[model samples]
Target: MIDPQPDGHLPVAAEKRTADGTAPDLEHGRMINGGENLWMTEIQSVLAQSGTKKTTAYLSHECRMERLPHSETYLGGGREIFQKEKPWEFLTYTQEGRIYQFGNPAVMTVPPSSEGDGTFPPAFEIKGCNSQAHCPDRQIYYFDYDEIHERLLSNQISVRSLFLQVSWSTGGDDWTLYSPCRYVNFSNPAFQTSSYIQPIAGTVLMPVGDSFVPGSIACSLNDKGDHIIEASSRVFRDMAEWRIRQEQPPEVARKSIRDVQQVMPTFFLSQDHIIPINGTVRLYRYL
Candidate 1:
């Protein structure tokens, strides 16, 4: 587990910029097609780093948001309504037959934007169900990505990284996490087909004090052909530490050392799993 901050919060690193005062280079180590949009360029960088040849930038075709449900439920008659006031402490999504249970707040659900066409801007729609009462129906809440981008640019909000869960179904269901500019590989052979693919986007951390803590998406399958998805902060902590050690100078890394680990600027993590599914499931998040 990541060591908790002295003040009981996750460490936040300031956004890095190039010496020229431009966005940090997404393809720093490798030579790839540098695109106009920094976000898309960073995603392409990830694909290139993951051993994907002929990497190209693409926008998400569809996006959906889901969160883990509260453990306790309100029983009325024969129906059980998921509690909305308090969500489960952990983030999780599980599938059993047609019923799906999510354990985090519903982050986003919208169709892909057509603004830049082939290019990816920080453009998207944010919506969720109303949490005011124990309403069983989902309500439409609307917001734009420009507002979010403005907040990040102005330092009104501090986000460490944006994480996306990419999923597809071939003979079975396969999914992986994707973050722009992070080196994570989804080695499934089905990824090459690029059919029935969906990208679930969201932040990987929960708010703590003035900053956010890191979390990871863990995917698994069961004999019953069910998909088990979990949001694990512990796994994210380990990955962050490993990345830090890998980036250190060879000589400095050779020595035994203990440093407060922080999720580096423009960092992300992703994993892949496969199972049988009827259709695609997508997720997205914004704050």
Candidate 2:
């Protein structure tokens, strides 16, 4: 639920912290990357004032509850978060609406020693859902928390029933969109299907793209010889070595399983403001 100041938000930017307990005006302040004085407070204020909300009535008209149709994003990728090292590191790379999250710098370390937190928890989402009969790629969607009242009105089990969708109702000049990831747990008695679990010590361990920066067993370096990127790989190895040392990861968890489904997943239904089959308009459709 981290919000933002009224304007100017994050990802892949400079971060400079100010001293003396003063806050920078994000609306006009300079960008800083991973600094103590990062514009968190200012950003929070913005998110509180401008978060998207979906009312029950809106849900009824849109029929977004119950059945959310599938798209290429989730057509096969069940939950890509676990596969990614830094899923939360996503930033608004361009106005084309392409979201790029940095890949873990270290791809092989089992559980790395986090410079900050451990690893990102877990999350499942439907990457794209089309609501219109004519436009198959018109609707882009993700998941969000629902309120109790809405769940009662919709008559569903589990506390995590709410959702939010993102598509073409947006316009900006290279805006920065920050979406935090969340994981769901339903196997425990104390935990409901909707109950979420947060893992500590979450941090990005892998680097984006294949081919780790060339490095020696004694040391490594990114293509640029920067140590931060190089050191990250070593840090990621901490957990892996321990696992191998202990022979962990449980044998059962090592296998991947797939099941059959009779019905196809669909969307929430309300398709207003959806740009209709505009060949001129190109959607950088995502998965």
Candidate 3:
């Protein structure tokens, strides 16, 4: 497992730049495993000799942080977090199984200036077919690409079967491939022809429901066809609070339950199985 340090330190050395501030020649930015020490040494030397301005200029102008797969696994690996130019987080909205991005050709065209005026136009053109028909059911979705990177690199769970490639006719000449909701109903003919596929870098999974609760359960199957039930910790902790409610007053119990519900650290998935160890740990299937 590539257990990258959480300090956000670059394990590999920042590449040496030319005197004219161009990037050093490289076929690709890939670095072999166990070669990080040598790279670190080179980077430290450059930083000490060149100081902050040179180092910043080189990284900003030539190098960019990107997530790369490990030598052994195709899933995920260490990633460097960079400060984004915009304050807003990148998000995508989906309408009628089609994705709409902000100010991009796939959705909207470039903003137009008011004719001969310095001010920009009130609105820009929306691209794509059936624009009016596809606007109503649009839902804002968040796909946690960073968390997927962490999960795959950490080897905590199998991500292979968490996604399925969906083939759908957009009423056009060609078909499109999309990753459906994990809890998508397979029996639905509209969502038929979804096959298991490996997720790529920056793959995002949005929640699978009309409304979301604090500890909603999302279900999916693994590559082995084992049902996986994922839920936030708040679900069980709230039950724990409910179990201990008799010892406290009504208001106190209510407060405790609410407190437990508010502190879910993360969502986790487990397979359906009963461990044959000293004690049984039964993981029930959600579906």
Candidate 4:
């Protein structure tokens, strides 16, 4: 496990190359080439010195968005279908607090392509466990870059959106917050010529313990012409309530709740779209 220095900075050796002249692998918290390490180094530096909020802000303004081509086809039923001509590209990163698992304060960066210049930015970064209980593993599944890239290229998975989350702690209590989900265009090529109906409304749920708190969901096109789904404020309130019920340490419970007062609902990848709830659920569409 990785350890933080006394001043909270990760070891400078974390960014150094191995003795054999090969760059360190991501599992070791280092990149394969000198160029690829730039963004990861920046993220680590920001987190160690500036904290989570500033690190998140830096990523938000710097990371580049994927731009896939699109096409339109006319169906026999006098309907038109619009879909992406290529698979969506993305990079995944995960960060965990040092307090857990013997100070596992490392960030894992998985890029879409491992070759070339190696300066690509991540699509999103995730922190903490999504489950109601504190997950001891602290490692996200399917975080391998090769596995995600293969799935996307083979059309086995289609990602409609991505979410960013950050976690922080005070004393011994852990806290997490989420940003609004951003809609992305990813379509299955096999279904490109088929016509499908888009639903106008649905229910949104935030997972807490064994149950879920429900809220209203609506979909519309943003100014950029991207199809977006939004959840009502009820979901946020329910999440706050769940955090309170988790019986956090008294020292940071009140502060954690107060800091997350304006927390937004985070969506998860479910089939062709991103859903507000976890578990197996029916897919909803908004046109």
Candidate 5:
């Protein structure tokens, strides 16, 4: 876990050295608890110190966006932003002596290649979880490892669970919010059992609308602790693809899924065929 320094500056973890003074191995892997880059450290720190309104203000000014809650911004806007390069590269060590490098640039800029041992995949996004009930989004973050314990003791049921959520975009025209398609959860091993799982730990992959569907592939586990992947029903493929494209630009995501509509069959199941004169029936449909 990241500890605050006496001077209030987050101390970046020093690189690990072998007995021969050589660097350790670098590979992109799953998420780690309290493992965030300097930029994330800054963002998390600001969010922790500032209240909801103040945190929103800080984020707006830093990202150069309007002072509106839930607005989005790119890193170093313009050509550099389009590149989506990661900045501030360095190595961090887990308590188990494992070293990991950062790879995603959207969360931070890519540092000079020579400076660090290797890069792990970048986090998809690092922002507050703003919603209708949680507008300012300050309560959406939980940095302390014991946060859950405290919440459980206090019966704070409305607190957010995941530490970070990375929403990846699918090939679509409409602007949609997507949870990160790729991530690792160190705290919860149960969630790691399946690829189609949602956020159950400090980091999670959530859909814009907080829903999930099976993809074109089926995942089953064997006795040897290996995941067996195979082709699945066409219906599964179409559903997963459509859910993914929710991250696309508004125009593209708004485009019709004509292929899926033509190939897949639709069904409507209701508890009753007729509505009662004085009773109301609620109908809900997922897009």
Candidate 6:
């Protein structure tokens, strides 16, 4: 579970960067929980001293902001409010088998570009994208390494599952593993692997928002193991609108916390209930 930075490579803190994501295993492999971050202190310190405030991050939106309630939780250990808490709050998209994103990926066909040394060749992200894929569905990120620039292009969600790893430098080039969006079906590298080593069973369930309206969404999972996702209609908020930096705004938006604030699971998975409880919560805020 060695998390590379949003972009592939960043040395982990000598102490925290245990060369892996979790505990070292001598036999098969090592698995260090990504949450045991060495930089938690720095984030806390920076926020504390710099007068920065923390709004809860969650699963559904473009930039991950899942700040759930748990023991030793960041803020006082009680239930944490995230994504500014939508009008009808308290659920996330992770309840169902939505291993990719809570929202849908906007589909666009890009031509080609000469900027990204060909990696982007005016593809989906190279050109421009529809403002639909932001929240929950857009909570994916890759390492921003000097090389291997992986952009979540505003196009179709082609891959079945994605494995995002983030590691970064802190003390003297030391790095820390952040969160992870582990089982994204849109980019599953093991798509070919068919043999099931273990048999598991379970159900997945998501929380629905206020059906108080005549037409409200009811989260549910359909057969064939697909989560009945809520496709957000025309996204109004743009990352540029919230930009606090002087640098040129990115052509594509990285998603806001509110988009994912459904606060309830989109649906539920019964058999082989595999849903992520705790993982990396990464995002770039405008304001």
Extract clashing residue pairs from model 3.
none
lDDT of 4 by residue, 90-128 (tens): 222223321111111112122111112112111232333
**Order the candidates by lDDT, highest first — what do you get?**
4, 1, 3, 5, 6, 2
What's each prediction's clash count?
A: 13, 41, 0, 0, 31, 71
Compute the lDDT for candidate 2. 0.20
Name the TM-score of candidate 4. 0.18
Please name the candidate that would achieve the greatest TM-score relative to the true structure: 3
Candidate 2 wrongly placed segments (more than 4 Å): 1-99, 102-238, 243-287
Q: Which is superior by TM-score, 4 or 5?
A: 4
Model 4's lDDT to the true fold? 0.27
lDDT of each: 0.26, 0.20, 0.25, 0.27, 0.23, 0.22
Best by lDDT: 4
After superposition, the stretches of candidate 1 with alpha carbons farther than 4 Å from their true spots are 1-145, 157-167, 172-287
Error of 3 at 85 (Å): 14
Clash pairs (backbone) in predicted model 4: none
Each model's TM-score, in the order given? 0.17, 0.17, 0.18, 0.18, 0.17, 0.15
RMSD (Å) per prediction: 24.6, 23.2, 24.1, 25.2, 22.4, 22.0
Over 1-287, each residue of candidate 2 has an lDDT whose tens digit, in order, gives 22222332212132122222221122221222222211111111001002243211000010111111232323233433232433322211110111122223333222332333233211122123111111011223221223222222233322221111111222221111111112222123244433322211111121112111111111111222221101122212234323333553535323211111122211121111111211111101111
lDDT of 3 by residue, 109-134 (tens): 22221112111111222244221111
Task: Say which prediction, candidate 3 or candidate 6, comes out ahead on lDDT.
Answer: 3
Error of 4 at 106 (Å): 48
lDDT of 6 by residue, 1-287 (tens): 33445433333351122222221111121111123221110000000001122121112212333454553535334555463544222212221122122322111122211222111101111112111111222222332221111222222121212222222222223221222222222222257422111111111122112110011111222223333322111111222223312243444322322333223212211122122222221211110
lDDT of 1 by residue, 1-287 (tens): 33434532233342222222122122221221212211111112111112322222221211122222332322223333444454433321111111111222222122221211111111211222111111111111121234333333333432323323334333232323333312222223344532121122232322222222333344332223344444433211133334546588756653422333222222123222222323322222221
Regions of model 4 farther than 4 Å from truth:
1-132, 141-186, 190-212, 216-227, 232-287
Clashes of 3: 0
TM-score of 3: 0.18
